[model samples]
Target chain A: MSTTLNPGERPTGYLPEGADINRNIAARRLRGKIWQALFFSSLVIGLLALGTLLYTIIDDSFGYIAVQTKIDPEELSDRPLAELSKEELIEILRANISAGLFRRFDRDEPFSERSKESVLQLIEERVIGREVVASFKLTESLLERERIEATVRERFPRARLEFHSWLNRDFLTRPMSSVPILAGVGNAILGSLWVIAITMILAVPIGILGGVYLEEYASDTWYYRLIETNINNLAGVPSIIYGILGLAVFVRALEPLTSGAAFGVTDSNGRTILSAGLTMALLVLPLMIINAREAIRAVPQSIRQASYGLGATKWQTVWHHVLPNALPGILTGTILSMSRAMGETAPLIVVGASTFVVFFPDSVFDKFTVIPIQIYNWTSQPGSQFRNIAAAAIIVLLVTLLLLNATAILLRNRFKRSY
Target chain B: MTVAELSAVDMAQANGRYAVELHNTHIYYGSFRAVKDVSLQIERQRITAFIGPSGCGKSTVLRAINRMNDLIPGSRLEGRILFHGKNIYDPDVDPVEVRRRIGMVFQKPNPFPKSIYDNIMFGPRINGWRGTKAQADELVERALRGAAIWDEVKDKLHQPGTALSGGQQQRLCIARALAVQPEVILMDEPCSALDPISTLKIEELMLELRRNYTIIIVTHNMQQASRVSDYTAFFLMDADRAGQLVEYGPTEQIFTSPNDKRTEDYISGRFG
Candidate 1:
């Protein structure tokens, strides 16, 4: 065949050898450089979005720990108010009331006529330092300190006012209240602990056994397939559905077992700690089952054959060999399930977890409120201070969930097999 | 040699020595025929090698000897597989007991997720081998020595068995199979996955073991059969998708002067 060339072609290497090859190589390099830049820019953009989200959450919640407050000494003198003749105590409270504190009073009640309100405000502010003192004894001690600080400040005008953040002892000890600074999460903490304990007790064994059965014993028949598909579907079901189920089955059907009969609460509709725990357990049961089944199924078949070849019975092979190998994965799954259960609010609320509980959960049969419910209550209130308290509660819950997940990760890493 | 001479030779070799006998045995996986009708006798105190190409059903037949096929979901066997003249697959026979008596070593080494000592003790403990701790220790040492792996692993008996080298792991598996004091041992390409050195060591261990126990090994390595086996059975796939035994005699006779053209072609390295 005769060779021909276009005018701009290499013309059978008329000028220099390998020129066309060099141009082709440069073009390929340029294309690859462009592709690399595009890929890296996409990755950077995705990570930036994630970083921005995390930054926003941290910024919003950090105000709970950062807000500074100055307690005025003149506002903290004890006035022997209850023991004083009513008229004299009212005169002392009126003299100390500030314009800022007085402006919040009801407009119809003249300042002098609102003696009860004015006296209560004096006791709350002067005796308690703008924060509710926990006990009668603590209130007396706070009043004495305020009197001493007032004397010291008058003697030394250059002394700076000692300011402190409001997230303190009162914030941790008192129960939820309309007054945000006076509220604490002691009851909610106890309620969360009880729910977690009960959920672990109810869910772990049943989930593990169900997983073992589905992975090891059951044949790959249509019935088993349907069950497996349903379990995966159930894991995605809304939390409210589980709450309704718990309300019907645990609260109503098993009312006698949970609530003592002495109250004659026969309706079985009252929310109790037991009912809330059972509801949360049901909410996370499908997730635990699916994860545990996947863990068990991931065990190598050669291990099973090796056990059987050693003359081990089926149960012995499973109990002695299989379960131990799959335990790390199972624990990881259970930890994730527990984290989901701890943050769930809808199911607990549906099961009648109270929005306002003054005392800790004294028994499983008693009414209770968890941390998420407390946060929800605070978020719905009409005060910025309550919002800060809600943000603090969210931080507490996130830290607790992080610790649990870290423990699961540690166990999973420690026992992970090379095979 | 002629068929008559081969029969005489087999008879002489079988005199006063028989560990397993298969009579008109066939194996199937659901509707797919794997091992066709075949008859053979494995002599005690000898290494009998089943040599064939891939998919020739050598491993299938070896699994049938100990009734290991029973573990497969849809695998079925016909005819008789007799161990010590007792039908292993009889209705009254327990497969577990048969496996305890006749141990197995798979192509890939599978050590339990346990200590080296525990891997060897598993078989004896399962069979209720009541003895002093020292006696169990002695059995483990003896089995390890028999498999030629005692010195390399003796210091780390408490370590996980899976931590051993590939060759050491295979030897550990052999030692585990030997710990049960089985009358017969089935090895299905035990050294196929090993390096040349490990393969030679295992072949030597098999030679040493034949002095006390019967060994039936399935191998794709023709050199291994010639080097380690006293008698070799050459199996080939038939038109019906079943594997048939084409020749069975002394290794030297089959490798040097086979009576069948297919056997001759296979021994000559022309085709599998």
Candidate 2:
């Protein structure tokens, strides 16, 4: 410990007996600068890590792919497959493929009722299916275009070669395919939409209501404390546990209800969109409640006092003042939770989300496969081309999550400015 | 004028001159008593001030009058607070209804997070005012006028109530309290957070509000009490640190002539 006296200068009592006051102050300032630098570097490191993740996903999505086809498209058709009109494509498929297959297509969906792009896609899938044999990253595809073309020509003379981006407009609308090049994320996107919609619908109202009960209505009893403690603990529980619970309860015991067989939906069993949605709802319920409670707690006590002083009942005070003020924070938490639910793969997988559904979910009872499941399925395949498509699926997931977060940020800011 | 002097203990013999009467009231938080044996009469249509040092529970007693203490968890009130010859603490008597008849202004200005118009209309709307748009507008104007903040905020009625300056916000709170047309308004150190100019404005407004609303204010400012209040109650903390009233009388008599030496010393700035 240092005790000191200074003449005509500010007395820094902590200064050492013979230490120069200015030097000590300077040393502390230097230490502060070092701490500041360390903090700033940590921020940069975080940003760098995030950038690397996004870059890796994006780089895999676009590239050169050397594709091999079983039969030459020119030999079967009058022109290139890409040059044919949608009607011509459909006509060729109808004439070429077996009657049984054509009948199956009709049973699934009428070709005449399908749009031009869909008809073209069907022709490409059923008739002129292409196989992706080799793929290259974005940088190689861009910088070594001539070399890539030369290598493709030398390697497989009969195979078609072109610059291909795994991510395209067709990716959003096309159904799952065994052939990686022909695969699209349409079914997975639709399934993700269905499950997320159901999850949010089931989670938000119930979570917020539960929060209101805990924060406003419930007294400090042992029961209240127990429930509060359990909810707080549940937020940190690994999501896969919820998946097991959902499988047991929603998929097995309540199979009839979950599968909508009670509603006479005989096509799907217990492994349906409803079960996955319910599972996700259970997964996010604690998170949503915790966030809502925090938002509600952030409301000033004086505001509640003001409302009470004005003769408003508890419900009135909560509805008009507390909830409105807490709404922005609540929405931010809900959006983040929704993003978590969107990215969740393990829970849906356990709850029996299909990994290879060709059709979009028509109802909550329909078998479903969300985007993460699609990516998981694709990445597990031995084909390097499948990894490319998986990366593309990751891009889709990221974009959707980003859009959701952007909307949340916009909504929060709007509320913040007003309140 | 000493400690061992005659105590003019007038226990709630208030017939009708007082708008509110507390008889042997003790305020407790959970199991801890905050104020003990507080018995006082707040006169009708006049400003009565509860003046005391810090932690003396002047605010607690004021909050008890409108049952605002009910908002606190585990808070209990002993004895009776009579409003218009009715025991407000009766189980059948809803605290919300009591608060409706007797509104409150907080120490810090707490206007609702709403437009100025909505802030004033919150009470009336909740009280079930089915009126035309023009009528709602007129009511907002009238309330704002009553708080003497109409001219400054008339054109900015659509703005957020929180955007107002500290003084304007306090006035806005007063306007909000006045909107429901309550018979009494309890102010808890309403000017303590304000500048001297704003304090003067609130004090002057209190005098103007005395014609209709029975106003009881809790303040640490002795000069404010001497200037605005008709009746003054001096509360002192007892051995248990529980606040109890030591003197209650006309403001002039209590501020100038001594009833208790303690009150005299407090008035002379010798001690609080």
lDDT of 1 at A380: 93
lDDT of 2 at B58: 93
Candidate 1 chain B: worst 10 consecutive residues by lDDT? B1-10
Candidate 1's residue-wise lDDT over A49-135, tens digit each? 977755543444433111121344444345444555546655555566665555555355665676665656555555334442121
TM-score of each: 0.80, 0.90
Q: Which stretches of candidate 2 lie over 4 Å from their true place?
A: A1-19, A69-129, A417-419, B1-15
Total clashing pairs in model 1: 2
- Candidate 2 global lDDT: 0.89
| Per-residue C-alpha lDDT of model 1 across residues B4-90, encoded as one tens digit per residue | 443364466555478889999999998999999989998888999999778888899998887778878789999998766668888
Would candidate 1 be rated incorrect, acceptable, medium or high by CAPRI criteria?
acceptable
Checking candidate 1 for backbone clashes, the offending pairs are A75-A126, A76-A126
Candidate 2, chain A: TM-score? 0.86
Error of 1 at B141 (Å): 1.5
Winner by DockQ: 2
